[model samples]
Target: MTGRGATTVWHEENIKRTFEWSAGAIFAIPLNVSCQHFNVSKDEPVRLLAGTNMPHLMNLFHNEDFIFRNPFRFHDRFSNDADYFRHNKRLTVRSWETNLIQDVNAFPLDDYPMKGKGVRIMRFGIAGTTYGCHIQEFPVGSRSTFHRHGPGAIVTVTQGTGFAMVWREGEERRRFEIRPGSIYSPGDLMYHGHFNTGHTTMRHFAMRGRSPKYSQDRYRTPLHDMIPFEEEPPEIHKEYLEELAENGITEAVSVVKE
Candidate 1:
């Protein structure tokens, strides 16, 4: 290696050292550190999804590096202290840097009753992670069952047009319109349902924490019956037709029993 080539080699070696020193930290990127990745084999491609507390940190710090060096230092040795994390579950912060990726087609959709036709879900849960997410799809006119779960949910609509309806036990139901750019957070334990009243299929990325309450039971409670393939009562059918016409939706929807 000579001149620029030699400099590049030096830089690469320094970065390798940095990664070694920063190992076991959840997404903590120190100041002046850089990263590089390589594909050593034809085994599989990489899929990366990352979230950070940078936004919240920005609100409190004039210097980003200061926060991590102090309070976040523990993250670097988190794996070595599993007992601390298991005991302080609510206070521990989880972070990950992953290179593993798999084809969505490789995983079969769960046959649970909550899913709808043209609807498929791929759950992504990592060991020791408090947060989990899934990529979900709803084909045209498909809608999910009205259900409630323990953990708060944040959703980013990636395609098509739709709306989500949420309601608490005593509160009136609220509907929020969603599109490709929409980001919605329906808080924990709210009864909610999803509708893709579009001509094309709709997709979204959703996330929630694996909190203690989330594991007490099935995690999901249905508020309404499954979507009906057979003819609904005359009044119910009329209401469905009216909604379809009002929304300029030509696609068919399952007649869900209320």
Candidate 2:
């Protein structure tokens, strides 16, 4: 809501170096960050009840009742499982938002034209270690539904202020007065999300998983890309498209018709 359009603070300076910066000569910028919940899946009860009673339990986990994992939960070996990641069943990166289980950026804030004040993904790494560069802007009064990720992620506040919380069942587990420069994290299965907790608009960066530990195929599909970008992400903010194109990646994300 700064009339300054949007402000994006992502740097794709090769996912192989530290994102720390210097003022002019040499200065380590103290980046403020906090992790809320360290677990997003095992730490929470997923709706596994959807397929609990099938007599052929083996068949269920494979044919009828096996719960399909979202990109975040994709284990490295899934690619070998034909029933799930079979050659024909393999998943590719779909459009980030609408293509999958969640709504793509409903209120689009063009990361470019908006002065980067909107949502975005920042890529970073150092020598071989992992780091997060993804960022997001939550318009006032917005809220995401229940979901989980396989990555132990972090959320760093770069702009705006708001409230965020973690939960188990329908109860409010822990809450934070999300403010600019504050970081909160959701552990592996810490079933959680947030609203534009502040009366004004809210924005933050989500660090998706460890950097160097991520597998190569992880970036290829929404199933492994994590971050919940759906099957056919909407004709999104042009910045995202441009980023994919720059990475030598293509618009090959897939969709399964119901």
Candidate 3:
């Protein structure tokens, strides 16, 4: 997610293409393609975070050589087009179906008031993969509604600082401190929410197994899974105020009323 680098991909018919990227750049490699990454800067090391379903694939195939050295070419998923990695301006609902996002930190987002106050989000469909990704931002002193979904979501904090409360039904909640570059994943069906304590808006990117367009029954999160602000326990808000106080933030940043 940091530094500058380039990826060279060898596609079908011996076609080769190179994509250059920097911090906040998001892209996906075509399935079964031969690709190599290079760090462009000598002084700064590159850190690329990738999410894949390789574990499931490995378990299903039970063969490393076939999985890694397969000759199968997903011709429909990739092409020799010169603008394959260019940013796509088209958006379906809040989703952007593209191969690359130049800088997610600077990308505009659409309002998602259902998630929380002053929250914005943009979902991404990358490289025709069933996997999904999205960028979400919530205002400071605010928190998202507690919700639960199936596992396989890897979240990376890209801006601001805060903490996440995670738990299961009828269990004690655990607080995990979060800051820029922090990565975490909530376990299967675990209830979780984020609280932004920093002065600026908190933003995070999540790559998961379910996509907005491609519905998967195994990973679907029903509407009833979300715990509304009014339904949450009073102690949740009480502890949030306590945390804000500990951080020396006394501003009257109105939180969602319980």
What are the per-model C-alpha RMSD values against the true structure?
11.1, 19.4, 2.5
Best by lDDT: 3
lDDT against the true structure, each candidate? 0.48, 0.35, 0.82
lDDT of 2 at 131: 35
Which sequence of candidate numbers ranks them by lDDT, best first?
3, 1, 2
In terms of lDDT, which candidate is stronger, 1 or 2?
1
Candidate 2 TM-score, true structure as reference: 0.36
Residue-by-residue lDDT tens digits, candidate 2, 134-239: 3355544333333456545667655556556565445555656777656676766665555443445565545565432244444444322222424222433233
Off by over 4 Å in 2: 1-132, 169-174, 212-216, 223-258
**Model 3: number of backbone collisions:** 0
Residue 95, model 1, lDDT = 21
Judge candidate 1 at residue 3 and give its lDDT.
11
Return the TM-score for each candidate structure: 0.51, 0.36, 0.90
Model 1 misplacement above 4 A: 1-67, 70-113, 126-128, 211-241, 245-258
Ranking by TM-score: 3, 1, 2
Error of 1 at 160 (Å): 0.9
Q: Which 10-residue window of candidate 2 scores lowest in summed lDDT? A: 21-30
lDDT of 1: 0.48
